[model samples]
Target chain A: MKVAITSTGNNLESKLDLRFGRCGYFIIYDTETKGMEFIPNPNKDATEGAGPASVQLVASKGAKKVVSGEFGFKVKSIFDSLQIQLIVLKDNEKKISDIIELLNHENLN
Target chain B: MFTIFVLNICSLFMSPRPSRLRKISNPPVISGFRPYGNKNIKGKVEAVFLHFEEYEALRLCDYEMLNHHQASVLMNVSRPTLTRIYARARQKIAEALVKGSQISIEGGKIYFDSEWFLCSSCGCYFNNPEKQVEIKECPLCKSTSFSVYAENNNNEEEEEEEEEEE
Candidate 1:
């Protein structure tokens, strides 16, 4: 399964972005193949409807789960309908690499 | 004057529309029920559709044993509306029992309430967006020791007060 984690920077060393919609980058990590891709958030500077647009970007990548610090009010129902699981990690200091490690542990279980 | 009189007559004949959607704190664990051992019945029994709101009403009132006013407050609906839903739930249950029809619980003008959990190891709060799957561990740290987070109600009340002040 592919997991999408919002990040503050392009590299895995950066902390997890608290805001899902305006996150600087999205890290797509595939568990089976262990491939990672970083896509710059196109809606990072969007004034309106950034949440749903970001959702579309992640959905298009076929990520089954989304890890972010927070999701907007409008994005929950959309994700619920799409059957994409949302994982809200409230720790602002958690890095992308730590989250990826957790995901790997989850896959092993 | 004549057009106004006709409009008043039309309004009187029209049915009252339903109120806003009710908030359901918990979704039903099972989808529905099935009837059996009815030799007198033929093939393909008719099924009664029960709304999720009705199931919640029944649960809050009958199972949880809360009063109408309290249940309505939890559901975010009026007492009378809750009583009406409860009544419908009973009536549907009775109809299904008598006719041996399957009861299928699905579809309603309702919004689900997400529950938050606190990870003791990570000291982080996260909400379970998917209700169908059981959360076994913390999403971040994979910790087994966690508790259900319940501070959101106070936060909501505070936000409401802030809105009122603004």
Candidate 2:
């Protein structure tokens, strides 16, 4: 399954982004192949409707799960309806690599 | 024919208004209750459906020992509305008990206050979208030390949560 994580930067060491819609980049990590793809959010500067637009972008990438610091009220229901699991991590200081490690823990054992 | 068209528009305004959405803090743990130790009828027994809002009203009033006014405030409904819901709940339960019918609890115009947890070891906050399953350990750090996050959406709910080791 592909897991999407919002990051503050393109690098693995960058901290997690708190805002989901306006995040800097979305790291689409495939658990099976251990591949990582960072896509810059096109709706980062969107004045309105960024949440739904980002959901469309992530859904098109075939991501089944999303890991983020926080999700807006609008995107939660959309993801819920799509049957996509949302894992909210409140620690904004966590690096993107650490989140990847946690996601791998389940697959490892 | 002209009068029939006007009557159709009049019927639209004559219907009663829909009920307001009740805010539920915590959903019931069990979906319903079943009666046992009864024998006679072999086939399936009749079921009494209990609404989620009615269940919340019962929990707030009977289980938590709150008055109708206080329970209504918790449920985001008026006192009289709470009373009506509570009355319905009691009536259903009574019917289920007397007739040996199953009590199935579901379906109501209600919104739940999302439940969130705070892991003490990792200092992370997470919400459980699936309310039925229990969270034993922290999803990120796998730690057991945690507490319920009392969201300050508007109410000031104070808690000094201390997790005990088993």
Candidate 2 residue lDDT tens string, B144-165: 8876666873154222222222
What are the iRMS values of all candidates? Answer: 2.7, 3.0
Off by over 4 Å in 2: A106-109, B1-59, B63-112, B131-137, B144-146, B153-166
What's the lDDT for all of these models?
Answer: 0.87, 0.84
Which runs of model 1 end up more than 4 angstroms from their true locations? B1-65, B68-113, B151-166
True lDDT of residue B74, candidate 2 = 90
Minimum summed lDDT over a 10-residue window in model 2 chain B is located at B157-166
lDDT of 1 by residue, A40-95 (tens): 99999999999999999999999988889888889988887887877788789898
- The number of clashing residue pairs in each candidate reads 0, 0
Scored against the true structure, residue A4 in model 1 reaches a CA lDDT of 91
- Candidate 1 per-residue C-alpha lDDT over B1-166 given as tens digits, one digit per residue, 9 for 90 to 100: 9999998998999877767778788778798999878899988878999999999999999999999999999999999999999999999999999999999998888866646777787776766665545678987667898866666775998899999999
